[model samples]
Target: MPAPVQLYVYDLSNGLAKQLSLQLTGKQIDGIWHTSVVVFGKEIFYGQGISITSPGQSHHGRPLQAIDMGETALDEETFNEYLEEMRQVYTADKYHLLDNNCNSFTNDCMGFLTGGSIPSWIKDLPADFLSTPFGAALRPTIDNMFRGPAQGGSSAPSSAQPLASSLLQSVAQNATGVQGSTSSYLPTPAATPSPPLAASSSIAGPIQICSNTQHFNNLLSTHKAVIAFFTSHTCPPCRIIEPVFERLASEKASAGVAFAKIDLGSAYGGGQIASVYGVRVTPTFLFFMGGKKTHELKGADAGELKAQVDLLTYQAFPPHPHASLPLRATRSISLEPILFTQSVNFEAVRSRLFSFIDLSALSDERKKSIENSITSTIIPYLKNKADEREGKGKGVNTSISSGAVCEAWRIASKDLIDNLQVKDIFPLADLLRLTLLDNPVAQWCSTTAAASGTSPPHAILERVASALRNEQQIPKPVLLTTLRMAANMFTQTVLARTILVTRSNGHHTSLTTLAISCLLHDDSLVRTAAASLVFNMAAFYQAPRMEALRSGRRGEAEEEGDGEWEVELLSAVLEAIKMEESNEDVLHRLVASLAFLLHLSPFYETQLKPMLEVLEARSTLLAKLEGVEGGFTVSKKEARALLEEVGTKLCG
Candidate 1:
């Protein structure tokens, strides 16, 4: 008997009961209260009840045993009757049962109206609940110290007590039907509170939030925005505002204001992400302007959060309101017309986002909602731009303010490049197919720069490259061409960036392969460019690649001679390099690249003899062209020595 199973039911929604007793609730047990179970009414999280008693003198004397000795369920109405009956049947022995036996678990709060001490269990519940990591990794890790020892750490365990309680309280109050103590009851949420809104006209305060470029792209595509709070459980100010967020997420769900929370990475020194947003403390709120960041709030309150949301959503998130009033409060909101009017076809995108009326939270549904919102708003804008170029007369320069000419080129001829697809892993082919080699998305990506008030083509390119690098699926050619063009035009970035990106294992190609390509290219610039990346990429695979070559040649006579593969590959590389040898500006990367290749696999032994002969002949020919004459000069001499060093590395 845990002090004889004395039941104390309390309702937080009603002030009198809450004041009379501390509340015990989770979504499993919210607003409704009951002692006697009736199918379903709210008596959740009743973990196994323990029959606590005075401990025996032995160290492991079986912790308090559980017994249903006086277990009872009371529905609100029946509970009232039960309470009345209990009052009548109350005796001195029951009071003694609680007063002396269970000090850790108290019924003291049971004597409510008059002040009484909180039970140890009530105080410890939060820590115990947090200790269980169920459905919680994605949730904000509010506390830095949440990992401290369970009970013997001397100091009190860190618990976002107030915030946790608020979260529990809201969930409990909103929940309607819940199964009781029995394990076999079918579970289902009878009535779920509506989720929060996705719009903001500005809840209050001038705040700006900056998103990484990818998120910026997604938001602009959907014509949507969000207010995010970066916080931690250990942060005092964050702890204070978390309750405000829980309250706001529920109360203003109908307002279309979206609220999100993020916990900084653990390595960030006690949640120091505020530094990126330029705030030095916890509880920083930011308001986003379109996809760009607008302002930051050093501290936040509920009113401020809600108001900022209301303000941003009304003024920024939506595209245009419709002509007719909705018959009911709908999950969808009209986009503001101002957004579409600026760009002739942007309106199509607006209608698209408006079509996503997901009033649910299943993962698949949520993914569809986000995807639909993006395609609807963005595709139309792209189409309109396409239509604008209908008859600009072939060869007529199409670089308007939006730069439609080059885009028209990519559109008129997309077949030159291959489009790739990976089934069921979320199709990105559609997105890649839309990429124009003459640079439509990058240019439109440039408009994002206007939103950011700076040309972010390089930043955008870097982000795209970063995304592409890790993509295990081969990238579509049009996308590669478009990015390559962007890299070229952004001259400051191309060489170093291409080299930087080439080293990444995202879809690695060997230096030997590129060297072979450069030797055979049609254009000097293209060949030179490929050769440069080959140099850097080879460094990472150097010795291992060299060893593989040596091993492949060791049994040349016994080989089935897939020599045609090597012959074709090397022929292509040499042709590419020979074509680009005209550009003196690229000579260094060429020589250094060749040097890098020769350094890895010796020219005489581990390679196709014909390709090396072709490459050396081309180099010797280039050296003879005025100052470009080449007989593997002193520099080439040094490079060859380094090659010798690489060849002898294993022997050493």
Candidate 2:
């Protein structure tokens, strides 16, 4: 029978939002909604993590309304198992006020149970508040308020405790409950009631709690292999083998393998589960593969259980194709970005930049302003950075601070970059590129640009990209400097690399677009820098793919646009590979970039494989390896090997 699910909505503002919302936000929001899912005889809500009680018994007290949210086909046991899986996600520390609060959890549950969503008005209150001017001003304060005392120096909102006087009365009123225990009718949460079980984020270790047949069947269907331990509480042998089962689960439970425990005599549908599998004895272990029972053991034998589990795991996740090839040198290629570390005459670069400003067709006031900024702020900071790099002043206090450098660049980006003629932008860009090599400056610029604001944090990079795209014939120096700047962005921090590679939005200004444009440039120097840029981007994309292949699960942080970027990058590199001829260094970079983009790709069969076949990627790579006049020299051997591996292994 399908169970009815209701949405219990509460007003956390306790009636204050009705009076103040109109004056504060210029919108008439009735209440600050806190919601919970009441389903299968329990009221589940997320506050300091997930909590559960009988319907109408939570501290939030009788809901503003119990909305009929339709019914769920899932049995109680199946839903309980689903809630167990959700524990790792809806953790205490992950809770937030405006973003990921009680309403968010209930909406997720509502969708899962009924294939429907909560009312949009209830969920859109935060958006409404931020949409107004006064409310927008108070966003930082509101955000801090919910981050808790540990993080934001403010205590979390106090959840109202259930009144002591109502405890006996509430229990008496709800005597007939799910478990038919007097304690089940009480307002207090059940024992295993905490939502966020402090397990490692992805790998939940101990043997999973299995209380129903549907969820167990769901587990068997999803995993490559499953081990079900059927045991009885009265059996001494069952107790002896329980620790071994837990150890195996802790060691082997992953996306591919699942470990579950079903007590055959416990109160929660255990006898039904036992009867379904025909498990007539205590300590009976059943192994399933491809959703069929493969092996069954009846004893407290730890050795047999461990052996069977190991064999199934080994069969499920076979070794990767790359493991068979002798491509250790190819796979071990350094991922560090190729930097423009050649020391330059800083004084000469500074002098020429100022000279360009002096010679430019601008007002004297504007010229003086640029000169003062360069002299007073930019130059000193660059010198201090240079000194830090060369280890010149080890202990002495450098007068130019990081804050001053940031302020100087802030002015340069907002005031100077846009106003200057395209010809003069290069010198300023070149100077700024050198400063970006410093880790602090790079991290600040990368993270700030991701913030929501009117002013872009990386305005100078934006200006450089704009000039590169708009100009009909760019000077070689400007082009080379721009490519080098793009390549150098991969250094210092992962945030910078992620921002550069995964940030394309159909804009010519994207760093990915910039790299593709300069890839097959007429100048080999420009091509080399462009290749480096592509290599950096490819390496960033490939790192997680490699880890995913190893772990059999994708990370939570991976973006949806990754597949689109991969296809785009692979297409551009293949075109560049066919056109690349004379310079072995350029060819090496191009070949290496292709290898990183293709190796261990999760979408190889669906996306990359067909694309590779269409592009004749194999023949193209073979031409690079064999068609070389004398073949690659011994020093360039890794490049040849990498090309061969990509053609034969990855392209297939």
Candidate with top lDDT is 2
In model 1, the runs with Cα more than 4 Å from the true position are 1-529, 543-571, 602-604, 608-611, 614-652
**Deviation from native of the Cα of residue 56 in model 1, angstroms:** 32
Per-residue lDDT tens digits for candidate 1, residues 226-265, read: 5667765468877777767655543332112334454542
Work out the TM-score per prediction. 0.21, 0.62
> Candidate 2: misplaced stretches above 4 Å?
1-244, 252-320, 352-373, 394-397, 421-423, 453-471, 497-509, 548-564, 613-616, 625-635
Candidate 2 on 222-317: residue-level lDDT in tens? Answer: 566888999886999998988888767655654456687777766444566788889999999999888988889999999998898877766765
Top-TM-score structure, candidate number: 2
Q: Which 10 residues in a row give candidate 1 its minimum summed lDDT? A: 331-340
Residue 36 alpha-carbon offset, candidate 1, angstroms: 53
lDDT of 1 at 172: 30
Residue 126 error, candidate 2, Å: 23
lDDT for 131 (candidate 1):
25
